[model samples]
Target: MNAGPISATAAATRAAARQLLRIVIVGHVDHGKSTLVGRLFHDTGSLPDGKFEAIRKMCERRGMPFEWAFLMDAMQAERDQGITIDTAQIWFKTEKRDYTIIDAPGHKEFLKNMITGAAQSDAAVLVIDATEGVQEQSRRHGYLLHLLGVRQIAVAVNKMDAVGYREDVFTKIEAEYRDYLASIGVTPTFVVPVSAREGDNIATRSQAMEWYDGPTVVGALDSFQLPATSVDRPLRFPIQDVYKFDDRRILAGRIESGRLHVGDELMFSPSNNTARVKSIEVWPEPSDSDARPNTVGAGQCIGITLDDQLFVERGEMASHTTNPPVETEVFRAKLFWLGRKPLEKGKIYKMKIGTGEAQVTVQEIEHVLDTTDLSSSTTSKVERNQVGEVVLRSRRMLALDEHTRNGRTGRFVLIDGYDIAGGGIISMEGYADQRQLVTQRAKNITRVQHGVPTDERERQNGHKGGVLWFTGLSGAGKSTLATKLERALFDRGYQTYVLDGDNIRFGLNANLGFSPEERAENIRRVGEVAALFSRAGLLTITAFISPYQSDRERARKAAGEHFHEVYIKADLGTCEERDPKGLYAKARTGEIKDFTGISAPYEAPDTAELIIDTSNLSIDQALEELLGYVEKTFRS
Candidate 1:
């Protein structure tokens, strides 16, 4: 293919409108990643004037073979060491599209830089030495491609000339590497045999290897498909900053995914704040006669002004409320550890995801994978360069989606003091609000055990340590009976405390809401608090309308064996007719959503230590039966 000259204006216009694809070349060190990229650049005629000839002259003057790797090894240190130390990007164009070839360092010492380069790419080209077959870094980089969600990949079995360009040798290496890639859940698009230094099977097919036939490197790159983007998906604009220009406040950011338009309502996650897009603001102010675009889609950097002027800042995501991002403080992630120290449980570290930064702790190490063999290994802490699955607990809730659903929001990086220690993807969401305390046993945090045991405290207090958890629908007389039982236990000279649902909501659970998840969180918080009181050697009476059996079970687990689940039974009709707090009527009128026994589900306990028929039995009779069970259990 021959090329034609172009004016500066035409080139700029072509660059702006051309289909752009980011392609990163990765492999083991001294296996020709830089040479492959340099060869591609030279064959495509993408180099500037006299650049290639200048490198050849430099190589000749230094009494060395005129190597193609010199074009990409631009740094003095990399040239001195004869290795790629950092990721370098160069622009090239095929007949199909424009390309930014990212030459990633294959050396293990620069693995972090390689990760950064691969994360930014849309597709990847993995290189392997044909004679070496498959090295350690080959499997490691392939595993990382799977971890980072780079599905479009092509393998170039380079250095085939060293093995005499034999078809049998290429076939053996290709089969072995294919199996390794499949083990890590990656199916390469093309595995082409090539000698990058000799410029064979790169831009064009090599006549020397006539028996082996496949698309050249350039053909494989062009064959990779481009994904279409539209505004149909949920909006996820991570706020970069809030700019104030001449008294006008605008939120400035690049739409990572989805779309934004004038008058579209957006909800900022973690904060759960809502606002309307008043206008789509852009830079380099248009003339008075010029018209502006009404909407903007993904990858566009634009400033937007909200309908209501409020103090909205960075680190918050702009998303639609109908499809809001999941907000949680805990999630399961797979990360590549690059820290100098092993990642320890309960050790605090700063995590940066999108625009949000928070203190996070490695709560649990599920398992670590040996990247070379793709085998699972048990480890208490994740050492440097090892890929591990872990449970992380952030100090604040973050808005995120699973990587399979949204790559932009699902990814994060851990910063250790001054450097990026690790980077990973969120594979799954977890219950965060109060269930975190349940993992306290697995975390490495210290728990002070005093000289006085709970047995001694209970003996001195004249009662056994336990939590009596009352679960039922609203207006089921759970709170009333719990309070009455507390007084009876107190009068009997027993240590007891009552935790009412509404009372705790005003203090400990003030931030919680009526959503199903929030309600679960509410129950979780009360469960932990009740467990604390029980540990303090008190008979803790918790009266809550915890309608979910799963949540109730978690509460029981958090409170331990001393916890007893008591069902306060009352039919919805009977509770509605009572209307003690006017809650049922409001629930029926649709004034409140997710109201238990009405809008939402109410899961009754299958087995309870005690059941009170509050509908049939009077308040006094119910209190007497509950107090009877409590006294028998605690005072025994």
Candidate 2:
């Protein structure tokens, strides 16, 4: 008999069954993670025909007990070492859908491999030895999963047969692990007691655990829904490379998120250059009969030609102007350190984010996290295999997103010399997105030309006008140096004035708060006023913490050649020891929010005109050097 036509609902269900889900299985060493995956493949009849028999024969020839972990541990080194050293991926299926099971290594030495596996998975299965309950590695694995943004998790308490399948034992293990996972903001979907060796509670309900009423492992696996597709998110096409082919310049990259179509306007970030997509191109050009695709979504690797000949380069991110990625030089990060040496503050490392690379310094280490107990402590360094909250500063602006916003563009790795030292997720917790602040918004305003020429003013004053912008951490002696320098310049009959931070805030910027945006605006206003003073043939001295490099750059642009960046350098420990204003104490006591060198970030100048190290130099010595430099440069 011929079959009838399939209904729409049945056809949709069949299509859904073909969809693939990637799952990473992680746990402590010898916790049966590999065994669980092997058993799942066997129970579902998804293994190759002779694969199972070959494994049994090998075990018999070696005079060893038949083991399920051997099914996934395929490497000769793994078999000899009796441990999985790398991430093993295999395909398996149930009646409902297909799955890619990634068996991640659980040994502490191979945790980086596990992290790589978990990073590519949509869901996770955390295995635990029932006898061991929750080990330190178990808690560490759970925290790593959370850090990788794996929310859909199932905990399989293996080795139940070792404990005689006791209901209290299972309950105790489940309760302890559940509490630990909850502490790190991870609530597992289901906690099932399973004996992978005997196939209990793995593919079917276990008869031995009669008191247990939760779904089996297979049932829980089928219950997880796929995460939202990247195509639904905003467009983030980072230019990996630029290919010049004949007459066309093809911008090649994978669409990290969102969609791109022919004629769509693309705004390249960090550069802020715009262009229109002229045509989409693919390799092995289609025939005349085959219509070329006009649109492409996330995950597709394609190239496109633009309408204009723009100087686009590698490391530029393409996005819609309405929803561009956050442009910033400094951002907060939650880092997982894996380096042999501890990650220390003020140390420079190469950061790879998206397709771009930049040199970033560890501006501050907020705290080192104890993953096992979910406790945090203030620290100056993050040790190997530890996690910490850090603030990283880059010299140039980076186009990125917060991890919660877009995982693909939000993750990055730090390279120490040649090895991968750490990986982290970006967060703009206390930082501002500087896109709007940096972009020019004012329109149609004309500058009033001064009647007096600058040279004429210089002739009258016997010296050229200039700005000495002193920037550093609090207690770095910026105000002290600025006041003394002003007095010395006055004694020499040179016109000079000091614009201290407190004095400016008392009047011109009193309405502005200490928020990142307000701080940028405050510096902006002070920079303009200082520029006016310099234009009037007077040396202007401004003393402020002015933490962000971008703000300082703006001030330099406003003053042109007259701007001189003077870095009053002092180590944080020395500044705290001085604590001249008692502000550092207030910041430590939680009385001040967004305090630089305490809770906030302070980006030291990379190419300052002069650096005065107050930590080592006496007040008189620093002042003499400063006065000599000013006289030699500004005096005609």
Candidate 3:
């Protein structure tokens, strides 16, 4: 028997089956992203036989010079237009490991395609023309890479031959771009000067520039470390479907991370259902008597039967009891919009994360980012091809992880009328994981009804007892209004009290801190206390910067009909200028963490019973309106 020679594509595929790293090359249009990729394959002898010759012969017949970029721009339209309009993927190898280089388009109109490539890459190569230096698209691509959480980067200063291979030219571009990246919290691993078209300093060092001494482009790529394997991370098996074979109910899904074993305890998230894995099931059972497997790791598709008949369904994630995904109804996302129409607040869109899909509403657009200059401005909507920080709300809780923690379950896409309009990475920065809060731990509890009637208490006090919950930024004057209103009610022969945020923290909520979880717990405890005070025939006023809308909703649920939300409205500028306690200054200077209207978010009420704009009205005028409303509504 004779063994046949393997084809280049087959050989590359076999090599790719081993350890591989994904790298996406991006830059401004005509900056040579595709050219660098093509030169890399040619220099490394990674191209198939006759592939280069065919391209060169075609260019000769067409009366055009042979272009290195033609090796990557395979599409006829791209070659005709002299620009890459889509992402192109190819496989090559270095002595160290196999590589999948993604050539993403550099044209501004094709940014969505660029984002698609960058999202799937483990690292990135940013190309810039040595003669042109940095351009608008260069900064935009750099910012997008950082937004997608690609930290390992190498900047390739291509077209160095056009600039005569001057070391000073490369240094100037390096310093300027490095500072820009650092401002956005990214540090490139290396910046190498190369002329991809001339094949200088790509695979080998450039001999033309004797003043420069640094690693070649290949060296920079080889230096990037591979990300930690998924198997070593926590388990996250999203239930894709359920199959009933004979009498066994099998839960089917792929192991996105970690490992699972037979008899291990599993907890399904967003539902909080628990059961033990009865058996690890696989098709075509092992023929050998002792060949049955009992465990599975990341990237394997398998099914398992649970000991108990739990009502598990698709969209629920299975994980070990110790480390589960965060369960929440609202979360923050850094999203890139690609829809022709802008993404507006209060509009509902379908979100797909892992195997789960849910309808999510755009709660707020934090800010629309200017990728070219890295400046952020408040906007009502996110325009096409723009990146923005957004808050999304779902009616039901969803199981997910922050992108920084686990990339597999942390990313999602938005579908609008059957089109992928946007995509983003999840972040729970200013929100709490509501798993513990939603779980009712008490085994036996009963409500005790009050003996006294509310009408009798109101007759005795000459007014109805209720809670006036004032919510706003810290310097919006919630505390001042609450204290003054309490005094006015007392002088008018009404039983009244004020629960200031600072005063409550000193005693009742002494154990609570300013963390998202602690802040939620603090609001929960105060809501219950304020409700009790209302039931006792005293007008209770609460002054707290309850920044989260969900937290305020919980408080409203606690008080029911006796609650009246009062919104103290003031712009961020006005509050900062007032700076009663100088807290905003401290927050800007990094002295305070998670400070509302500064480092943290402040969710204003959309259904407040009364809205007082403190910026426009004096304290006396605002108080008069507040007093009139209370007197007209609460007087018996």
Against the unseen true structure, what C-alpha lDDT does each candidate score? 0.84, 0.90, 0.90
lDDT of 3 by residue, 387-504 (tens): 9899999988999999999999999999999889999999999898878766767868998888999999999999999999999998899999999998988999888999999999
How much does each candidate deviate from the true structure in C-alpha RMSD? 13.1, 5.4, 3.8
Which of candidates 2 and 3 reaches a greater TM-score? Answer: 3
Model 2 per-residue lDDT at 301? 86
lDDT score, candidate 3: 0.90
lDDT of 2 by residue, 52-146 (tens): 89999999999999899888888889999988999977776787777778889898899889999998999999999998888999999999999
Candidate 1 lDDT by residue in tens digits, 532-623: 88989888999998976657877888789889999999998999998799988998899987688886656678789999989899988998
- Higher-TM-score candidate among 1 and 3? 3
In candidate 3, stretches whose alpha carbon ends up further than 4 angstroms from where it belongs are 1-17, 53-65, 75-81, 282-292, 449-465, 487-497, 535-538, 571-582, 615-624, 631-636
- TM-scores for every candidate against the unseen true structure: 0.71, 0.83, 0.89
Candidate 2, position 111, lDDT? 89
Superposed model 2: Cα runs more than 4 Å off: 1-17, 374-381, 437-453, 462-464, 468-515, 541-545, 564-599, 603-636
**Model 1's TM-score against the true structure:** 0.71
Better of 2 and 3 by lDDT: 2
